[model samples]
Target: MTSRVLTCLLLSVLCALPALGARPVPAPAADGMAMLQRVDTARVQGSPSTLRTELDAQQAKAPKDPMPRVYRAFLALPSDESFAEFKALAVVYPENPWPHVGMGLVYVRWGMLKDAAAPLETARKAVPGFAPALWADGLRLQAEGKPAEAEARLREALTKLDIPRFRTDLALLLAGRPGAAAEARALLVRSVKDWPEQPEALQVLSRLAREAGDAKAGAEAGALLVALQPHDREAHRRQADAWLAAGDKAQAVKMLERYATLGGAEPAVLSTWVKLAVELDRPEDEAKALVRLAAATPKDPEPLLRLATLAEAKQDVAATEARLDQAAALAPERADIQVRRARLLLKLERYFESMAAYRAALAAPERPVPEAAEEAAQLTRKLHLPASPAKGTVEQIYDRVSLGLVALYLEHLMEKPELKGNLKVRVDLDPTGKATNVVVLYDSLQDVLITHSAHVAFMDAQYPPGSEPQVYQYVFRPPPR
Candidate 1:
C-alpha cells in the first residue's frame, strides 16, 4: 500500500480497535468510513477545529461506534476533557486497545511521559503489535531522551508497518548521536527519494550533510527544501549557508540576496553578505549590506567601523574620518576607534593634532596597542618635542654652553659654506620652560635641510621654567658663502 494509505490505516488503528461485549458494534459503513478518512486528512493538515467538526459528524452518522469519540479525544485541549472522553470510551468498550492508545497519546501530547507509560503498556498487551501503540511509545521514549530505546521501537514499528514518519523519527534519533551522521543521512536520503515531498526528511538530510562535511549533499538537500518551502526564510538562509560551505560563493551571494529581498536580512546575515561581497571584489554590494546592517542596529559600532576600513582602503580620507568619528561617538571608550582616528589625522598631515590624538588613545581606559604607544613616541621625536622637561630659568635652562650646544648640532648638518639666509625657529615650551615642540616658523631661504637641522637642534635644547607654553624665536645667518 502507498504510504498515504498506510498512514490512514495506522491512524484508524488508533481510532477503530475492536469493541468488547456479547454483541459488538458493526464496522463503519462505507460513507462513515469516507467521513473518518476526511477527519484523518484534516488531522494531518493541522486543522484541529475542522477535524473536531468532522469527528462530530462521524459520531452522529455511526452512533454506536466508539471510534469518533476516541478521535475527538485526540483534538481536545485542556486535555482533561480529552482524558474523560478516552476513559468513557474505555468504559463502554472495555476490550478495545484504541481507548487506551488514545489515553497514552493524550499524555504524550501533553508531554507527560511518566503518566503515559501504564496506558500504552496496557494497550500493547490488549493487542500485540498494535502500530499506533508502538509509534506513540517510540516518540515518548525519544522525548524522554532515551534514543536507543526509541530507535528500537521505531524500527520495529517500521518493520511491521513502513510509515514514512517512522523512518524520519529513527533518522532524527540517530542524528543526535555523534558518529551517526552518515547513518542518518543514508536513512533520510532513502526516505526523501521514496517520498520526494517529505520536507522534514529533506531538512534533516541537509543538516546531516552539512555537519558531515559533505557540502555538495548539503547544498542539494537544502535546494530541495527551499523549493518545497519557497516562502520559508530560514530555508533560504540554510541553503545560502550550505552554498557557502560548498565554496560556491556566487550562489551563496545570490541566495542571501534572495533572503534579504524577502525581508530576512538580519544584521548577522547582512554582515555575512558584506564579507562575501568583499571576497568577490564587489565594493558597492559590500557597502549596501553595511548600510543595511548599520540601520538595523543603530547602536552597534562594528558596522560603522567596517565601513571606515573600507573607506580607508579606497583612499577616501574624508569618508574614513567621517565614519570613524561616528563610530567613536557611539563608543567613545573604544580604544580601537581612538587609534584609528589618530592614524587618520596623521595621514591628513596634522602632526601636532595627531600627536595629541595618539596620546589620548594611548591613555584610554581600554589600553591601545603597545605599537601605538611606540608610534606616538616616534611622532614626538619627529616633531621636535621634548621627551621630558627638567625644572629651572632661561639661563639655567639654556646658558651660553646650551647655545653653543645648539650651534654645534646645527654645524654638523650644514653645507661647507652654509646657505646665507635668516632661519627663524619658534620653539613651544612646556610649563617648565623646556621646549615641548619646535617648528621652522619662518624659513627665508626655504632650505629643507637647514630647517630640519634647526628643528632637531631645538628639540635637543631646553629653556628656563615658565608657567605656560613659551615661544622662542632664533635668527641664524651663514657666516660665509
Candidate 2:
C-alpha cells in the first residue's frame, strides 16, 4: 500500500478505537457487542499478549459472533494478511453489517475511494442509520470531491452518535467552507467541552480564533494546549503571540520565557521579549533578553549596542564601556558606536580620550558622523588651551581661567546679555587639580550678578595639580560680538 494509505489506516485505527464499542450492532448480537466493549476497554489497561488471550477466550465463548474475529483481523491491520482475514469474515458473515463496514474502512484507508463506496453502502443497507458506515462513507465522499454529500453523511452520522471524532471531523469539514466558520467554531467548542483532552479540536479552535481576530479566545485555547503538551515549543510560542495580541504583555513574557527555557533560542523570539520588556519598563528582563540575543546572533551588533545603552542608563559606566567595546569590535566601521564611546568618555571628564573617539567616529569608513568633527575640534581646543594645567605654563593658568569664564558666559550668562562685564576673580587650585574657591573682587560693569556668576563659574574650573594651594587672578571680559 502507498504511504498515504498507511498513514490514513494508522490514524483510522487509532482514532476510531474507542468508537468501535459505542457503534450500534444488531439486537441479537448485544451480548457479543458488550464483550467487544469490554475487550476495547481492556486493550488500554492490558498488555498485547493479555489482550490476545482475552480475545481468544471471547471467540470461544461466542463462536457465532464475528466481532471478535473482526477485532483479531484489526490487530494485524494495514497488511495483506489482515485484508484477507477481513474479506473471509465478510463472506462468512454476509448478513452482518460489521464485516462490510470493516472492508469499507480498509478500502477507505487504502485510498480506494471508488471501491470503498459499494461496501459502505452495503453495510448501511444491512443496518440502517449505522454511524460507522456513514462516517466512513463521509470520508470517502470527501476524498472523491463530493463535499455536499460528504457533509450530509457526516451530519447523519452525528445524529446517530455525537462522539468527539464525529464532531471534530464535521467541524474540520465546515472549517474549510466559507461562511460556515460560526457553525464550525460552535461544533469545535462543544467537542472540546465534551472532551477536554482533545488536542486536535483545541488546535483547530486556536487557529480559527486567531484568524477570526479573537486574540483572547486564541490565548485561552493556546493556554489549554500548552497545559496538555507542555513540552511543545510551538504551543508556547503560539500562546505567547496570542497573549501579546491580547495586550497582556506580562503573560506573553512568561510564555516567551518558557519557550526560551525550552531551548527556543531564535533571534526573533529574543527580540520580541526584549521589546516587550522595554515597553513594560522591566530593565532586568530587557537585559536578560539582550544577553541571550547577543549570544544567539554573534555577528549582530544591535543587541550589544542596546545593552550598552541600558548600562549607561543605570549609571554602570564600566559595564556600558565593556558592551560598547564588544559592539565596536563586531562593527568596526559603525560610527555610532564610536560616538557613544566618545559621549561616555566626555561624561567621565576624559576630554583627550573623548576627542580621540570623536575623531575616530568622523573618519569611520561606513556611517561616519560628520558632526563628530566639530565635537573633536571643540575638545582639541579645550585640551590645547595655554592655561590648561596639562599643556600650559603656570603664568598662562589665567588663560585657562579666562576660557572657563567664556564657556560659562556662552552657556548660561549669554541668556542675560545685559549682564556682560569685565571682572577680576581670584581662583585657588588644590593639589588635586580642583578649584577649591573663587573670589570675585571687582566688576568693571559694576553688576553684582556678573561678579557672583563669575565666582561660581571659576569655582567649577580645573587646573594642573600643584604641591600646595596656588591662587591665580584673571580678568574676564565678555566675548566681542
Best by TM-score: 2
lDDT of 2 by residue, 302-399 (tens): 99999998998999999999999899899988898899899888788755457557767887888777778777667655543323232344555555
Encode model 1's per-residue lDDT on 137-195: one tens digit a residue.
89889889888888889888778766555667788888878888788788888777755
What C-alpha lDDT values do all the predictions have?
Answer: 0.70, 0.72
Number of the predicted model whose lDDT against the real structure is largest: 2
State TM-scores per candidate. 0.48, 0.56
For each candidate, how many residue pairs have backbone atoms clashing (under 3 Å)? 1, 0
* Weakest 10 consecutive residues of candidate 2 by summed lDDT: 15-24
Clashing residue pairs, backbone N/CA/C < 3 A, model 1: 393-464
